[model samples]
Target: MEPDRDSFTSLEPGGDNAIAVTLGILGDEWNLWILRHAVEGAKRYGDWMREGAISNSVLSARLGALTDKGLFDRVQYAHRPDRYEYVLTRRGADIWTVLLTMWAWEQTWAPPATPPLPRMRHIGCGEFFSPATTCGECGAGVEAHDVVAELGPSGAWPRSVPASITRRRSAGAKQPSQVIPHTMELIGDRWSAAILGALFLGARRFGEFSERTSAPPTMVADRLARFVRLGAIDTEPNPDRPDWVSYRLTPKGVAFFPVVVFMITWGQRWFRAPEGPALIFTHRGTGHEFRPRLACDRCGEELTASAVSIEPVAD
Candidate 1:
């Protein structure tokens, strides 16, 4: 169904929209890589430089921005040369779940290639495991279908779309060795991320996706096609109209729920609208507001940065 044109709104920067604010921060490829490296113990300026192969000026700018966003604490480590390192703050460390979920998605969906992402071993269980998103209150596993979403007090789409500063950079830049290319393709682009978010929000038709994302129809068509090729989304016959089809998440797409949930949780904590979070999710099974926690599939204990180690993918 085509949504009413007047019903949708665009988000402007610094608005009372948590998703917009969060997207503006983490939507960049470099930023995601930087945060990923930070989680992996890349603290020194040269550390991320070597790991990401990012140029100095861009690295400096990104570091500064991250510091400003309260994600990193810039501490001087040397006196004579004024050397400093970027350390993740509590809020920044919370991004572990986001990166872990992305890793899990890539492990399940990314085409195998050289130098794949390292395997994560849960130290508590002494076994490698993928992250499972679970409810904090009820301890039940969560998936996209298990929740009900409603617009919060400040849930209305904003007045203008937030600018995507990373698209051109990501398009022109070379792929980094320690990067998640598939995840980047899905989320490195703001429009794609918005479309994914829209799908999770119950947008099923072409027009609905376009309206919900505020993206051009042509762009929406292109992304939907790309997702279909990626096996993340599939098309089904629309019973309401035989000529029309609805787009729905395949298991692969549904598996991406953790990534979305983590991002939303991070955004809610770091950014806020006047009314509250832009979107509110409630677990239908628990009948309570859903708070996502990433736990190890092996031990069923909550995963933490200090409790896990990364190792080469076993042959």
Candidate 2:
């Protein structure tokens, strides 16, 4: 499926919503990497081939999809065979902040199996900096504990983001939980977020996680180790085999529920489907959809961009 006509052209028929559509367009396993490389100056077909290990067919498809999504505009640099280079448009450039947040998260909480590449420097500050998300209304820190539920239209919603509700069966409602800056490293994108999402949905073993996400076994194992280190999950012995191990989300890992739910909310609004959402979250046994909110813990207002601001990093 493609993004709703609002953002990009229809790539396929039937979508759950905008989140599904956008993910369909931009959330492919290799798509974001393509953007990251483009930002760093990789353009030629061969350049992608050499560095990204992408096959021609998949690369071609993703390139077309991204072009349709308005991120990349192609420029014909060659004439004989009409070869072209893909360049970033303003839309493409805009996603960099999302990427930067992910990079900051990886640096802080989820280091790769190999040593990380060179660090990012803020040109203005002339120093390596870790990015943070803060309340626009107040300079106070944004944590899980600092937010509340301001649900529905009385609650302000972004022009784009739709509301998310979880566990329809429960009489109780859910509030947007605490999310510190470092937590961005964990839930901002697919791999890390997908792991948490799958675990929350009840996949426990290594094989189960591998099956649930696009991540390969190596990435899964690496991230599981990182999560263990971060206290998001704990290892439990398999009863059938003493040597076999399974992973479960720690309480801290469980706290990431709102982030995944919000992704669904945001995706649904932007990536609309003809029929309905591709997937929905509900409580086990009761089978109720959950409704979630992003509220301010301080003034208890519905948090919006106009109401939030980033705080200066403490020296």
Candidate 3:
């Protein structure tokens, strides 16, 4: 059955939330890698081919989808057998911080061995630094414990991201050449992503998770087990009910909050709704709406793609 186009177009989480819609656009490994390469200066068709071992057909499909999704603007750079280069649109360039945050998370937890992930030099501070997450309003550092999240105007409605819309790796597809980070594993799966979001929202019991995410019991059980295996969450016997269990985020899981914050920031900024945002975060310290900003860990200045340089990582 075809997924509902109208439902998918909206930015709400209830069958039509922005986060799920954005995830449908970016949740695939190849899609993420393509965005990474784009940030690293890949534009022309040949540029991406040389940057990664992606096949022509796959790359073509990805580029087309990204372009259709408003991340890239394809422009003709030549004629005759007309040739074009994909340029990042404003919406596309904004993915820099999201990718940077993911990179930082990988470095700390899933360190790759092939070649070290590139060093980031913040030209603003003239120092090599990791990206830091901070509240844009007050400039104070932000963490899961430092903020409280509440359902926004649209958030109160129960919505389930259509499972069919999310892109998934085929069983026979080539495994991602880059080291798959925990962030990828968690976010790439719709159910897993929704369940983790539920945990952050204080859904400790199984029923709450299932209800909030609108995931089937089997799917929820499978992802919850996977989270435990990844050490992102722990399962504990419920104190009041011996028959049930509670899921709690481990330190590693809580550490993933920055990625979630960035994802929410990017998604909400790009995807709008007539009602309101799906989630509103209030910084515990400032008592102000939490808008996430990526800053240089060394000098505390905001990090921008132009203001920072990434040393290319070897494939």
Each model's lDDT:
0.78, 0.53, 0.78
138: Cα error in model 3, Å? 1.1
What does each candidate score in C-alpha RMSD? Answer: 6.6, 12.8, 3.9
lDDT of 3 by residue, 99-126 (tens): 8877788887775735566768898888
Ten contiguous residues with the weakest lDDT in model 2: 153-162
Reference-based TM-score, model 2: 0.51
Question: Model 1 TM-score?
Answer: 0.89
Q: Show where candidate 1 strays beyond 4 Å.
A: 1-16, 159-161, 168-172
Native-to-model Cα distance after best TM-score fit, residue 92 in candidate 2, in Å: 2.2
Judge candidate 1 against the unseen true structure and give its global Cα lDDT, from 0 to 1: 0.78
TM-score of each: 0.89, 0.51, 0.90
**Cα lDDT tens digits for candidate 1, 191-218:** 8878888888889999898877788888
